[model samples]
Target: MKHLSILVPDDRSGPNTVACIAGTYHAFTEANKYYGTLGRKPVFKMELVGLSKRSELVNGMLMIQPQASISTIRKTDLIIIPALGGEFLEKNFVDEKVSAWLRGQYKKGAEIACMCTGAYMLAATDLLNGKSCSVHWKSAESFHQLFPEVQLKIEKLITDEEGIYTNGGGYSFLNLLIYLIGKYYDRQTAVYCSKVLQVEIDRQTQSDFAIFSGQKKHGDDMIRKAQEYMEHNYDRKISVDELSKELAFGRRTFDRRFIKATGNTPAEYLQRLKIESAKKALESTPKTVNEIMYEVGYSDAKAFREVFRKITGISPLAYKNKYNREAAELLFMNDAN
Candidate 1:
């Protein structure tokens, strides 16, 4: 049997660790039971792994004793890092012991996986310096600012490369777990777990769920004014060049400062702003697509749809249908009719 080690969180991390560990442990053990029904021996020998044998979870309410310490486990087939809480990325809980041990295990041939914000600890190992990975969209900006070398693919629900795996926010970790189940076992085992786990097996993108509130923390007053202008005047067809001239900065300089401050070009910021507005209208208003498009300064149908899809990874009508309360009632009423 291959050893499956699910690494427990440190004392400084969040309570999210509790649920993440439980979910991961349950899925693998439940898969073993499924295998028993098929007359095959259990393939995974599972353990709750951590730096110490007994690690106290924070907030003084819970405690977890790992079945194996990383020091005791010389080698394992896989390492699972649950979603880390607190300021792991900010270095408040940078465990050099854990990071070094992870690299050592990888060199000895262990596949690694991180669920949601656990990507922080994975990156701490320098394993993801140049690799592509996904995490919850809410943390995308902070992760990018801290680890610019990493290719942050927050739009993706899951990313896999060179035996390392990561997934998007919260319960989406279930999808990552199912993915591993499939890879470790067989297709049937993965499928069986999917049905029992109530997880959709084909969810590919987290983009549709993303809410883009543009980065605005940078203290450049001119750039901030430019952002406010674009936001307040989203209905107007504005130009960065004209705005730059008005703000007494060259267009190129304005673009540079904007990118440095917001991590997006002036054009990208404008597009996101427009799409956000269109998203709100699509979700709440009974307005036509053309009306909303024109309302957001888009006159051409193709251009509007293209920008919408580019920013949101879904077409306008699709977003509306997925989220609109009015659309849901209309569908139900049509069925009744």
Candidate 2:
């Protein structure tokens, strides 16, 4: 396997800069964990290209680099352009030197990836015109106003076609890493990497989960109370009776309203919740699948695997194998280059 050389850009932000860098850093670190075990480690090198000192007034922070140069960036295979502080989207084009160096690298066939308004820099190159890409939904309106030539996909987590890839927002970094892991290795490696990163294994490709959809609604006060209890007590064996007593509602009332508000009955909700938790456990830790199954409320590993397949559309072992293969492939590629 070869190492994957990823270059992450830093700029001073409310622009979501830290989140973007954190995403790449998380993926790179997790990828390294498995790759190192097999004797191949990705070479990670960070560079501060332009703007020796960057600061955001609202964020109350400043970034000062004594050694700022684009040398390392010029030699990387993958360049990750992260959003700067709040003005990232509203800011004008980058300075000429940084822009030119990036353009030179892209011209030479390097893979260029951007997150959130980092797409703004990519768009400045005029390379994304008429090509479909993702921007954070919050900025979609202004982005469209500024760069009407580009096609915007707000619902998707990441958009990849041709050599350039753009993500919807900073959070989509997880999906991007998973996609990359699957593309270069297999599914299991991504899952394993996600697990090691302590992220819940998300099988759903769509970014809009009902839990995180627009307009965060505070449902019935009683129902919210019930859910709060359930989330905190996932490890405990609690019953509908117990919930009803604690919430001061009768068993009949608790069951009816809880199901109506959350769209799932208490027992069913608990099962799904535990499954979600178990999925994370499977990925992040070195525990056996059976051990994870038991830890997440399933007594039988066989049944747990079956349910996992039903929920995630792939077996646990398959997911792990896929990511392992991807990390191996990325390591090989980086080393060869």
Candidate 3:
């Protein structure tokens, strides 16, 4: 059987952390049950490994007892890091023993999988330096600020590179679990698990769920005012020249400051703001695509559709169908009647 170590870090205590651990454990065990039904032996010998034999968490309300400590585990085929909560500071909760153990395991040819913010721990080891990984969209800015060396792909639901895997935020880790099941077990088994677990198979991106609020944490007062103007006047045509003149800065200097502060060019920032407004209208109002396009300052239908798809990974109509509150209410009423 393949050895699977689910490392329960010292600070791994949160609402999502517990669910990720329990959910992943159940998924793997259920996969083994499916294998047994087919007259095949189980694949994984799973255990909760920790720094110590017992770790109290969540202010001592919960206690996790590991079957083995990292010191005792000589080798494992796979290591799974559960999602962490509270904060993303590396120095705050990182265990040096865990980091060394992870690096040692990787050198010994063990595959690593980090679920959601667990990527923070993995990244702390410097293994993800210069590597592409995904994290929760809400944590993207913080992760970027801390680990500028690691390529953060917030739009991706899962990233697999050279045997290191990272998944996106929230319950989306279920998709990653399904993906591993497909890889280690079989496609048929993965499909069975997807059906049993009610998880969508082959999900690739989380962009549709991400809300793009313009980054405004920098200390550029002029850029902040410009951003506020663009946000308030998103439905109007905005020009960089006009903004620069209004802010009393030269065009080139204004562009440089805007990019430095917001990590997006003025045009790109405006487009994102318009698209975000369009997304809101699509979700809440019974508006046609053209109506929303015009409402968000887009005159060309093709350009609007392309920008929407480029940023959100879905078409306008699809977004509406999935999120339209009016359509949902109408369907509910029809079913009731």
Candidate 4:
């Protein structure tokens, strides 16, 4: 049997932390039952492993109980890290005991899976250095600042590297759960669990969910002005060269400072801004894709679709059909009829 240990971190990520534990535990147990019906032995010997028996989280609003302490687990095939509560990069994330235990387990050939921002804890073990990871879009910047060597793939709902697996923000972990079920169990069983759990199966991208707020935290007044100018003029065509000239800086200096301060070239940042506005228009307004495209400063449909897909991983109409509730309902109802 494959031994499975799900780490119930000493710090909880609010009520969702417990939900992650329960979701993982429930899925594997259901897998066991599926195998049992076929007269096969259970696949996973599962335990909620932790450094302690219990932990309070979210200002004592929630509490979790671990079934086994970390020290008790002599060997395990897989170790899962659930999303953590509290600030990620703070001193609390540097839980030396848990970090050391994780490193020891991985060295012994245990595969590690981290859900959502729990990558922070996994990264704390220093095992993820030079590995690709996916995390919550909101935490992407912070994670980069803390672990630059860890390649962060913010657009993916899940990322797998070597023996480590991670998923994006919130309930997207369900996608990773479904993936593991299919990989370690069987595709049929994975489909069954998705039906039972009511989770979307085969979800692969979190790009549609990411909000591209400008990264303007760096201390550069000129760059700040450049960003604000782009923000206010996103609907109109603005030249980066002209903007640089107006700011009294050479184009090279402007581009360099913009990339340094915002992590995006002026052109890339402007594209994101236009795309973001177009996204809003698609979500809330009853407008044709062409209209929204032109309104967001893209005069060419082909150019607009290409950039939209490049940034969002989906077409303009697809984004609208997915997020515009009234349109989705109408389209679904029409199809149902």
TM-scores for candidates 1 onward, in order: 0.91, 0.53, 0.90, 0.92
All models, RMSD in angstroms: 2.2, 13.8, 2.6, 2.2
Each candidate's lDDT (Cα)? 0.86, 0.63, 0.89, 0.87
How many backbone clashes are present in model 3? 0
Worst 10 residues of 2 by lDDT: 207-216
Q: Which ten residues in a row have the lowest lDDT in candidate 4?
A: 85-94
Model 1: which ten-residue window has the lowest total lDDT? 85-94
Q: Give the clashing pairs for model 4.
A: 12-85, 13-85
| Model 3 agreement with the true structure over 1-337: per-residue lDDT tens digits | 9999998878756777777878889999999999999999998999999988787767677888999999999999989998887876554367888899999999999999999999989998999999999998888877876787888788899999998999999999899999999989999889999999999999999999999987777779999999999999989988889889999999999999888777678998999999999999999899888999999999999999999998889999888878998877776788899
- lDDT (Cα) of model 3: 0.89
Off by over 4 Å in 1: 219-222, 245-257
User: In model 3, what is the error at residue 101, expressed in angstroms?
Assistant: 1.0
Tens digit of lDDT per residue, candidate 4, span 86-169?
A: 665553456787888889989999999899988988887789999989988888777877776787888888888899999998
Error of 3 at 245 (Å): 6.8
Give the lDDT of residue 268 in candidate 1. Answer: 87
Q: Where does candidate 4 stray beyond 4 Å?
A: 89-92, 244-257
Q: Rank the candidates by lDDT, best first.
A: 3, 4, 1, 2
